[model samples]
Each structure stands twice: as C-alpha cells, then as structure tokens.
Target: MNKHQTIEILLGLLGTLLIVFALGLYILNEPSRLEQAQGDILQAQLNDAMTLYAESCAVCHGLNGEGIGATPPLDSGALRTMPFDDLYKTIARGRFDTAMPAWSKDDGGPLSDYQIEELVALIQSGDWNETGDRVVNLGLAPLIPFTTDPDPVLVEAVGSLPDGATLQTAIGIYAAQCVACHGTDGLGTGIAPALNDPAVREKPADELTRTITYGNAGTLMAGWSNVLSPDDISAMVALIQRWDEVPTGVIPAPDVSIPTTAESIALGAELYSANCARCHGPEGQGRPIAPPINVKSFLSSTTDQALQQIITLGVPGTAMPAWGDRMTDAEIQAIVGFIRQWEATAPEVAQPLGQASGGGGPPWLRNAANATATANAATQPTATPTSASPSVAPSVAPSVAPSVAPYQPGAEAGTGQGGGPPWAQEQAQTSGSAPLDWRVLALAAAGLSVAFTLIASGISSLKKYR
Candidate 1:
C-alpha cells in the first residue's frame, strides 16, 4: 500500500479501536452507571425534600425527623417499612384531625404531587444521617430541649396523692413525655383527646393497652411501644383510669415565679426592645418573624424556666437565636421575666401581624432599623464641616451603606446591600441545592475529548488525500 493509504489504514484502525473500547467500557459499566445516575437523581430529590421538610415540617417533626413533643418521628422503621403509596397518600391528604397537614397542592397545601413523591422517597429510603449533617451545616440544628427539673410544687403535690408512689412515677412519666399535648391531669389540649374523659375511662383495659402500645392510627398519638416499656404504659393507663378518684386540687398550678424586681424588669424591657422587639413586636405581639410571647395561652402553658431556656438556647431551625452565647444568664432571665409580666392581661389569642413563624421577615429592614436607631442614638454634633468631619462621614457612611442601599428603588439587583430584593434574597438563600455529581461531569469531559481527537484525525486524513 502507498504511505498515505497506510496512514489512512492506521487512522481507521485507531478509530475502530477507540470506538470498540468506548463501547466495551460502556457495556461493562452500564448497570453501575445507570445505578449512579438514579442515585444522583434520588440525592437531588432528597435535597429538595429536605429543604421542604426543614421549612414546613421540621418545626414540629424535628430537623432529623426525630419527632418533637407529641409529634411522631418520621425516620422511624415503621415509616420506612410503610408502603410507598400509603405514605404518599398520608403526605398528600394528611392524617385526619392531626397536625400533619395535607401537603399536596391538590388538597389546598403548598406541595405539588412531584414534591410529595420526593418527600415520600426521602422518608422511605433517604439517609437520615445525611439529612442531619446537612441541617447542621446549614445552621438549622434542632433546638436544645428544656432539661430543667419538674416544678417542685407540682412534684410535691403529686407526691402527696393517695397512691403517692405510683402517682409520682406516673406523673414523672407524663411530665417527661405526655404533657406536651395532654395537659396536666390528662385534661387534654388542642392537639390530643382528653384521657381524663369518661370515654377513655370506660374503654376496655385491653383496648387501652393496645391503644397505648400501638398508638391511634392517622393521629398525632404515637405508639409508646418503642419509647416506653410495657410497665410504664400500664402505669400511664392506670393513672388515666384513676382520674375520677383524684380531686381537682390534687394538681396545683406550677410555681414558676422568678424573683424579678422592678429594676430587673426595666432592664429586661430595654434588652427585649433592643434585641427581640423587631421580630416579636414592641409589645410582645406576634410579628411575621416570630410568634407572640404575650398571648395568654403561651404565658400560661410555658413556665418561666422554659421561657428562659428557650431564650438561652434558642429554637433550632427557626430565626430565634441562642442568646446563651450572646447574653448573660441573668440577661436571659431578665428577658423571660419581662415576657412573664404580660401573662395576666395577655389576650386569649394573638393577632399576629403576619405568619406565626420567624425567618420569613424582611431581615434587611430589621438590620437597617437597628442600625439607624443606633446611629441616631449615638449621633454627635457634626464638627462644623472641618476636613476631619469629611472623613468622619465617610467612616460612618460605610457602616450604614450596606443596610440603606438595598431599599433604594433604583438599586441594581444583587449589587448593593442585602444581596438583592426580598424575592431575590430568598432565591439566593435557597440556591444551595445538590449539584451534579463530579463523575457525570468527568464522563462528559472525557466524551468531548475523545470526539475532538477523532475529528482532528479525520480532518488530517482528508487533507492528506487532497
């Protein structure tokens, strides 16, 4: 063969080998590649679902699906083993008369069908460890639970009952686990049915046991089989049955009164205004950024210790910050004291200015208002326009510049102050979704490189033939 023909033959052979190699590689890796792609899609779905769960569900269900208060755990084995369709329906339509609201858009919820599916998949197969890690990375860790001892007066009251020992044990169990939804003495709250009612007392012993063990389906009442021993549940059931024998005054009001002098309250007032008023409202009325602390229900239900602890540790996954690191214990106590003073006169229900959740408020406004207020308070007389005063304005201007620039009507989007407009800000905040896997990108780059090599060889061969 001629040298050109030989060259052409060599190029053809090389191209053939390359093609064969690629085909063989693909054939060999097809199953794994498909699995990886599916996995990537699942991961993306999980990330999206995690965001939704964090925003809407985590406040009650917990950041790690660990369950908070009376809410049941989502990461439990029972949910994992639940049929996909059943779980999907539960999320879509919600459990009847429960806190688990219908999430699908069809049922007047915010989620679409696809979103609901993603959440179902996440619950069934997603890694809770990964979910927890992501939440922590995003600084949305679950709140530090209230760990204070039970109210001494309540403890003493229970201790003096007819069956003091059993009552004490049951009271301990109830206070530790059950009191969140079932109010003290099993009177029931907005969330759960009253155990002290005649209906519960009239139920068969076996039925009561089964209900406590297995929990009422499609309700917020979670089974105690996993959390409490059979004995503990029996004690709880016994406590419920004996409610008729127990007098009304047996369970006295919890004494959470902190010794707050007028001066301390005044200091707390100043501190609350300076730190908490922007979101919680100036008079403890609910604002869009926070729930009302001044509401009668809140003040009555929440003890002074709880209020202090909540302030100190802050609620996780919410905008409420942990003042433990920022303020002294005394300061937090003072703030709680200030909040406690509103109990007697607080309205039965709050007229919240916006949603009863925090973190949805315009952060820029809060920051700007605080900045402006501080600046105004600290404003000294301008030094008569001296050259030094020109520098002073420049120095002070930068401090306020970032806060002021974003609010201007004509400011460029995402250019000056607070990252962008409020909508843009939300978009920016939520832009950290899972990205394409590196392996996929690598494969694409490799394919391009191979194609480029083939094209170059083909062009050279054509030139040689000409």
Candidate 2:
C-alpha cells in the first residue's frame, strides 16, 4: 500500500477515537450543564422582574413594599397568608376606587404574566415578610428614609423657626417635620419607630436632646438639635414627655375636671395644634407617629372617658402624652374637645394598623398604613396619594399591545440580528443552541486540513518513485 494511504487511515482512526471520548465526556456532564442553564434563566428573569418593580411599583407600593403615604403594606400577616392566585388577580386587574392601577398587560398597566409571576416570587420570597410589625422598621421605603439633623449645614439650609415655640408649635414641627416617617401620633410607622415610646421619654433629657441634635449614628434617625433652638428642642422634648406619663397603650383616669365651654375647646384646639399637630396633623389626620383620631371607627369604638384619659395620661408605649401638669384638667378636656370636634369632619380616616378587623378598611390598614402605603395594598383599598406629581406611569393598559420586533435566528445567542452583546453574539458561533456544536465542526475542519496537506506531500514523494 502507498505511504499516503496508510497515513490517511491512521489519521481517520485517531479522529474517531477523539470523537468517541468527547461524546462520552459530554454525556456524563450533560445533566449538570442543563441544570446550570435552567438556574441562569431563572436568575435572569428575577433580575428583570426586580428592575421592573423598582421602576414601576416602588413609587407607590414603597421601595420595600411597606406602605408609604396612604399606601398599604405588602408584608402584612394578612397578605402573607393570602392565596397566590388571589394576589395575582389583584396585581393584574387592580382594585377600583383606589390608586392601584392594573399591572397585567392584559389589564393595561405594564407587566407580562411571566414578569408578574416573578413579582409574585418576590412577594412570596422569604424576605418579603419583613413588615407585620409597626415598630420594627426593617426594609423601610426610600431605603435611606428622610433624615432631620441639627447640623449647622442642615439647620442653615432649612433655617430656624420662631423662638418661644409651644407644644402646639412643636405639633406642627412633628407633623410637617416628623410624620413622614414617625407617623402622625408616634406609634411608629413603616419608616421609623415611635419616638413616643417610653424608652425615648425614659432616656435622660440630655441624652434624648443630644440624640435629636446630632441624629443617631449608623441609623436613619437624623438629629435636629442644630436646626432647632434649645427652646424648640425643649418644646419637642416636653411634648414627648407627655407620652411617657401615659401608663401604657391606654390612658389612666385622673381626678381632673372635664371642660366643655367653647372657650376651653378653643384653647384645646390651639394646644393640640401647637403641641400635638406635629405628630398628629393639625387637622387631626394621624401620622406615622400616631393613629388617626378622624377615623369613624376610632370615634365609635373609643369612649369619651378613654379619650380623656389619653389626653391626661398619654399612651406610654405610643405617642399620646400625659397632660397631668402641663395643662389644667379643663385644658386636657379642651384637647379632647378639639379631637371631638375633628371627629365631626375627620374625613373617615382608615383604621390604624391592626384595627381594620372591625373598621371595614382593608385588613392590612390595621398595620402602619399596611406597614403604611404598600402593606394595605390589600388593607385600605381606599386610601390614595396626595395629588402626587405624576410618576412615569407603569407599563400602561395591558390590553394595548406594545410595539416590538419579531424574533429571529440567534437572537438568544445574539448572533443573527444586530448580534447581541459581544459575548452573546460570540456564543452562537461556538457553544450555543446552533443544532450542531461548532467545536466539533472546528475539530473536523482542522483534521481535514492536516490530512489533505499530508496527502499532497505523499503524492509528490510518489511522483519521484514513478
């Protein structure tokens, strides 16, 4: 036989052996490779879903799903126990008479069914149960949260309030200044814990004042000592002290005479406005620091005696303050009278967190808004935003189709169309879903080239023999 023929046969045999070995190795590792691919796809889908949530849902539902201004909490115990399908439908169709718009492409908001599923995965994820408690401010919305410091810079920037600030004046301070996170009455909302907590009042006056001045380090709590005058800070501290006097969550009865005259009621109004309005809105619209006294159920459920006690004693663990000496019995009654007057036009506030069970607000509202705004998403189903600046509206009505291009070959591999990103486009050329593995073809081509060269050399040598 010619030398070229023998060499050719040897090359062919070597190629066959390599092919067999390669196939064997592939077969052994295929399952793990497929599992890895599946995991990657799931991860990618999750990333996309999270991005969508942040951009679309976070604005209202809260960055962490804890409710914000009138928004309900998503992590509430009631919602945690809710069925998956019901939750899906709510997210897709959206509730009427409320701010929640439909999210499904079918309904009109923006998310695809697959994306919604990922959102569900996010809601049901282990980390989602971060709410359900009013005081524990984990996963607060806006992440960093609003900080108020007494820094010279911050104080200079915001400027100072007038001197001789009264508790009523501080009420505005707590309301306009503090309620964004603390809640109206200081029960603690989704963002910050109750400054009304006895622990705060129990702390040394200097320590508390210093903490408020510098703001808490490594925490969302900012200090206001610099921005506020010593008198202003004193007024706030005094207001907080009133809450400490309350025996517990409920106020204890005392021997003070209840006032009812128009003059007394007027005085109470001013007092509530100056001292309480900051935590409870001037209009009595409860804040992160307190519960809404304007709520219909709150009025009906609570008694005059209880309200009076609250005015006199304040709720120890909460934001309510004791009036024991700061004001006369008539004055405490005046504050109660002011709250009573507000009840007449309180605007049917949503039940405070945890109390919606009988109040008819969504069960979620019972927790701070449903840990405030995002949680009640299931709860209040009734609250809405305060004429907020229009956000980048979510996907839009699902029924309307968004324009998109048709699929093409190597789209996933990123080669066919505009070739995907650099990596993806290259994948199609090599280890991709191209039907035939490119590596094998490459090996074959290399082998053929070498074989041909050898054959040509052999032929020339044979010509000499001839």
Candidate 3:
C-alpha cells in the first residue's frame, strides 16, 4: 500500500478503537451517572429547603445560619455533627427556653416532616464544617468591595482537637488534626515546620498553648479554639514540651557580650530592619503580632537581658519568631541596643502615635494615621534591608495601634494614613512582574511542534513520491 493509503488505514483503525473505548467508558461510568442524577435531585431539594430556611429561620438565626445577637447561630459545629434523628427531634420540638419555635407540623407549626427532613439535610450538608467557609463567604459577600472589610479578623489556624484529660490522650488529637502538616514525628513535614525544633520547645507553655488555640494567621492553620477546649490545648502544649531535649521552658538570657558602640548600633539597626521589622513592626514599633520595643512603656519595662530572651525565645502565640536559631548572641544584643535608642525617641514616637481623629488611646500615648504614613512615605529614613548605611537610622515605625481611629478598618484605605492594613501599601509593589506565564507558553509550543512534525512528515512523504 502507498504511504497515504497506509496512513488512512491506520487512521481508520484508530477511529474504530476510539469508538469502542468510548462506548466502554460510557458503560463503565453508568453507576456514576446514576449517582450524579441522584445528587442533582438532592441538590434541587436542598435549594428548596434553603429558600424555606431563609424565609423562616434566617430572621432570628442571621442572614445565613450565623445566629443574630441573643439568638443562637444555626451554622454550628454541633448542628453539623449531630445525628439526623436528634436534629429532627430538636426541629419538631423547639427548645422550651430559647426563642426557637417549633416548625414541625405535628406541633401545629407550618413545616411538615418532609420539610423538617429537608432542613435537617441542609444542616447535615456540612455548611459550617472545616471546608465550608469558602462557600459561605460567597453567599455573604459576592461583590467584596475593598472598603467593605479592610481589617478582617484573620484566623491563624484551623482544625480541632478531641477533648482528653491526659497528655497521652492528647497525642491522638495531634495524630488526627496536625499529623498531616507537622508529620507523625513532629520533625516537620512539607507543609509545616517541625514541632520538636528547639524554637518550638523553648517557647513558654502558655505561649505554645496560645499558638495551638489561635493557630497562626497568614497561613492555612485555622485557630482550633472553636474545636479544642482550653484544657485540650494545654494538654497539647505539655505533650509538645516533653519532646524537648533541654527540658523546654524559659531560655535564660544569653551573654550580651556584643559591644554597644557606634559600629555595633548601626549593624544592629540594619539587622532589625531585615529580620525583626516584619512582625515587630517596621522598626520594633509593635503591631498586632508583636508589641512595640521602641515605646516608652516597653523599653522601661523590659531589661536588656529580658529583651535578649524575648528576641531568642520570641513572645509565645504571636508572630515574633525566635532569632536564637538564626541569629548570634551579639546580633540579638545589637538589635536590642538599637531598640534602646528609641527610649529617647518615645515622646517623639508617642506624640505622633496619639489618635489622629481624636481617638482615645493609652490616654497619654497618641497615634495618628498621618504619622504612620509619613514614616512609611519618607524615602530616606525607611527601613533598608539591602542598603544599610551606618549614617542612616532604621526608619522602622511603630505599627498603628488598633485603638487609634487611623488604624481602624474603616480608616481611609491606601491614603498613606490608616489605608487598609500594612499589606495595602505593598500591593503597588507586587502589582508588577512576569507578565507572561512561561509554563503555559512552553506547553502551547510543545503541542504546536508535535502537530508541525506530523504535518511535515506527511508532506515530505508526498514530495518523495512526486
């Protein structure tokens, strides 16, 4: 046969095989199709049920299931976890104490057994469970304007721990909730850091417990406070501390052997901007995660030794990370000394920090958004990690206090004042970069190359024949 004829034959065979395989695949997926149809019917029923819930229940229970003030929320873990039968009983026989009325037809209410079943199905649908918040957010905020919620309550971590009296029982909680991210050995996993690391062990028990409870914000970890009881969290901390080799707990102040000379102070300022500025505020002026080191109250209260310990151990449960593992004793001391210089700058700092819009603060202390903006906008005094000049002071400014109106969520966004959170200003910097995704272009090129090769081969064969 000629090359073209052979090619046609092969194409015919390929088509035949594809048809057969397609039929087989369709037959194989019969059960799945049936299940999908069933799910669709159930979903339609859920939609109808939702309508009923919104009309009847949402008033007192909230627009969603989030209960209004005084009224209990319906989107509760208990409701999601409870057995259908138990839930049905509760719906039919409304709570005697609470405002929740009986909706069951048997109790002379409006809803029939089927409707109650539908509502039960909706609740059991897991709308408020571990991964349901995303869908919930869609229902709550479809437009999501920037000004709507500038300062959202950022959840630090997620997942729950089972209640247990002893530390041994607490391991089960870690196995179920945390083992995926942290790993069974706690040496760290791909997603999370090792729990047994010196940084984790040396943290104060209260701090560790708080971390477990709140979870870390700006990460996938959800605060387990909703799921785990205070006792459960404490138990986890105890279990974690036991893993430490040096017997976990307060790390003593390391030697402040680093001289506090001009050269050292300059180096310390540079280091603080690079390492400490992110969480501890732009320059040790504390933020939501860390308190201000430059503030009069902070400097006056904490000793140099205590500052060294804080820098090494890091305050528990907050964002302040331990420098002990990364930084030397001298480096930490230098940062401490840089912070001490601010003692003189406190009044200057506080005067600016006082509320801008007459917002009440620590009474004597002041805070204004304009001050925050000025510190942020000033190009010269800004914290420079890359270019540290001995002459230039670290321009790290205190994070706006939550109490200050300028720092409030409703404050003017992107105005250099309390515009949104600190991240808002950074948006301008991040809005540029790789305009094209090389991965996608590479894939397209690969597909085209294959097609070109096939077409060229066919033409080459035809030419040879000619």
Candidate 4:
C-alpha cells in the first residue's frame, strides 16, 4: 500500500485498539462501580435505620442494640441467624403480650412497612458497632448499659426474708429492670402501675408470675421471659409479696443550681444564634420544629446532665440532630447555661410553638448557606483599621477602599474565627481535587491519536487524488 493508504490502515487499527482498551477498562471497573453504588445505597439505608432505632428502640434496647436488663439484644448472633420473614414479622406485627410494639403503620405504630423492613435489615446486618461509632462521632454518649451492684440499703432491707439470697438477686433485677418505673420502693411512677399495691399483693402468685413473664400487654412493660429465667421470675414474685418489708424513702428535691458565667452565657448566645436560633425561636420561644427549651416545664423538669445529653445525642425521629457530633463539651455546656438562664422568669406552660417563617431551609442547610455568605463577606473590601504613626500624619480612614487583600496559601479562609464544626473546617481546608483516572486518560489519548492519524491520512489521500 502507498504511504497514505498505509496511514489510513494504521489509523483504523489504532481506533480499533482504543475501542478494545476502553471496553476492557469498562469491564474491569463495572463490578467495582456496581459494588460502590450498592454500598452507598446500603449506607444511606443503615443511617435511616439507625435514626429510627435511636428514636424508638434505643430507650429499651441499649444505644448500640446491646439490650438493656430484660430487653433482648438486636446485635446478637441470634438476630443475625433469624430468618428474614420472622424478623420482619417480629418488627412489623410485634410479639404478642410483649413490649415490642407493632412498628408498622398497618399495626398503628409510627413506622411504615418499608421503615420496618429497613430496621430488619439493620438487625440482620449486625452493624450496631458502626452505628455506635457514628453516634459517638456526632458527640452523643453511647449509653451502653452496665451492671451495677444492688444497693446496700435494699439488700439489708430484704435480708430478713426466708429466701434472703433469692430476694437479694431479685433486688438486682428490679434495680436494673423495674426501678425506673416501679420506683426504688416499688410505689410506681406516673408511667407504670404500682407493684407494691394491696391489689398486687392480693393477686395470686401465678397471675403475677404470668404478668412478669408475658408482660402486661398494650403497656410499656415488656416480657422478661427472654431475659429472666423461671427461677428469676419466681424470686421477683416472692419479693413482690413482701413489698411492705421494703422501706420507701421520700424522693429528693430537684437540684435547681445550674452553674454558668457571663462569659459562657455570652459565647452560648453567639453559638445559639449561629446554630439554634432558626429551629428554636430567637427568644427561646417554641417553634414548630423545636420545643420551648426556656419554658419552666422544660427547664424545671430536665436536669443539667439531661439537657446536656439531649443536646449531645439529639432527639431522633425529630429535626434535632446530635449536637455532640458538631460541638465540643464546653460549647454544649455553654449553650445549656444560656438556655437555663431563662428558667427564673420562664412561663409555667409553653405557648404553642409557632411555625418557622421567612426564607431558608432547615438549620443544617442554613449553617452551610451562612458559612458561604461569611466566606463571601470576608472576600469583600473592609475598612482596615489605620495605625497611628509617629512621623507621618494618618488620614481619617482611607478615602478609597484598599485593594483586595492578596491571597496567601495556607491562610485561614472564611471568618477564621473557628466557628462551625470540625468537619466543616476540614472540608474548607481540603481542596477536594479527586485523583486522576489513568484508564480514562489512556482511552482519551488513544482516541485522539487515532483521530489525528485518520485526518493526516485523509489529507494526504485527497492531495494525491487531486
């Protein structure tokens, strides 16, 4: 073949090779791409499931599904080994006469079918460890349930019983499982019925045993059968019969002393304005999205630690995100101080929280938007304060705005006041230039090489024909 024809032939072969190479790259990357997409979707699903669990399940089951005293753990091998349908049913319809409420909307619970399915998947995945890490990263406490020795006073009180050892064991169980509702003396709280009542004492041992084993249906009480053995249930029943022997003490007065300072309060105010003022009203009034934290009902009822924990963990199923992830301990404490200040004059009843008005999305989005605005503002010309000189007379502020400040590499961007979370700061620092894909570059180069060759050949062939 002539030079031009030879070139054309080479060009066609080059194009063919390029196509083959690109196809090979696609083949190699396809599985990984598919896997990555699937992983991303699964992660999103897990996050949603975690949120649901924190809101609904975490109180009864420990934060990481480790399970509280009598609550069976979701993170266990038993859950992972469970059949999908059984698991789905357990979460959806719930167990009969158990605390596991029917979560599915069909069963009159809060979650939809899809949400229940997501929870089931979460349980099956056994990813509570990672979920816990995510929660900690957000600055919330893990709230892992721990076993503590029974109160000496409680142990001493029941020591005189014939089965003192059994009663002692039952005290530990009661302290761990039932004391929250039944009180230290079993008088009962607002939520749970009094276990020390004459009516309860009058009930047959079998009836009480059945109630504890099966749980009081349609109530917050969950069956302890899975957690407590037959003997353990018997001990609890025995302890209940001798309830009068256990002395009840007066509940201690609430501690109203919340330590804070002018400086902390001031810092908290700034932080609140930047972070919380949107969802929580500007003046600590309630909003549709957030409750009135400043009102007496909230401030008086919630302890300092409780308030801190709530801020740190966030209220799941609500707009509240775990502030622990975003803020430091000092910052959170400062915010608590700021909120607590209103208690002295706080209204007894919370006024109906008003809906959010004016422009902007949720608080998180507002933070990003505000950050961008702050960055933009920093770039705009500002009145740089003039220093008084010994020799030269200074003008009363420069007539013309000084030329925009020179960009310095590694200089702090935005306000540089270190406002916002550590993550936001890290994001700001990262240039975010993704690594180059050699496979893509190679394909592009090969195509260009072939195209150049073809153009040269065509030009040569046309000249020869002319």
- Model 3 worst lDDT window (10 residues): 393-402
User: After superposing candidate 1, which stretches have Cα over 4 Å from the reference?
Assistant: 1-8, 133-466
Clash counts for the predictions, in order = 1, 65, 19, 4
Q: What does candidate 1 score in Cα RMSD to the true structure? A: 18.2
TM-score of each: 0.37, 0.29, 0.25, 0.44
Alpha-carbon RMSD to native, per candidate: 18.2, 24.3, 23.2, 20.1
Judged by whole-model lDDT over C-alpha atoms, candidate 2 comes out at: 0.49
lDDT of 1 by residue, 1-466 (tens): 6776676567666656666666666677778766776876776688778766654565467667888756798999999999999999999877764545667666656778998899998899887766654443222333322112345575576667777677667667776666544544554432345566776778887888898776665444656676678888788777787766554423322433554645456657877978897777777765545665666656776666456546755655679886655554445556777898888788765533323335344765445434433342243123112222223221221121112111122322212343433433544444443333544555565566567667766787788789
Pairs that collide, model 1 = 289-358
Q: lDDT of all predictions, in order shown?
A: 0.60, 0.49, 0.49, 0.60
lDDT of 3 by residue, 1-466 (tens): 7876676556555555555655565566668766766765566556556655643554345545665445677778898899888999988767753445567756645788988888888877834332122222111111111111111111011112222235444555665355434433343322245675555667899788777765554333545766678887886787677553212111111222222655446657777767765555554544443444555654554566456545655534556665555554445656777788877656334233333324434533324333443353343233331122111111110110111111122322122243433323444344433423543454455555555556656786688789
Model 3 TM-score, 2 decimals: 0.25
| TM match of model 4 to true structure | 0.44
Rank by TM-score, descending?
Answer: 4, 1, 2, 3
For model 1, what is the alpha-carbon lDDT of residue 277? 79
Stretches of candidate 2 exceeding 4 Å from the true structure: 1-7, 26-37, 59-87, 95-101, 108-115, 124-140, 143-466
Candidate 2's TM-score reads 0.29
Ten-residue segment with the worst summed lDDT in candidate 4?
A: 383-392
Mark the regions of model 3 whose C-alpha exceeds 4 Å error after superposition: 1-23, 126-466
The deviation in Å at residue 322 for candidate 1 is: 14
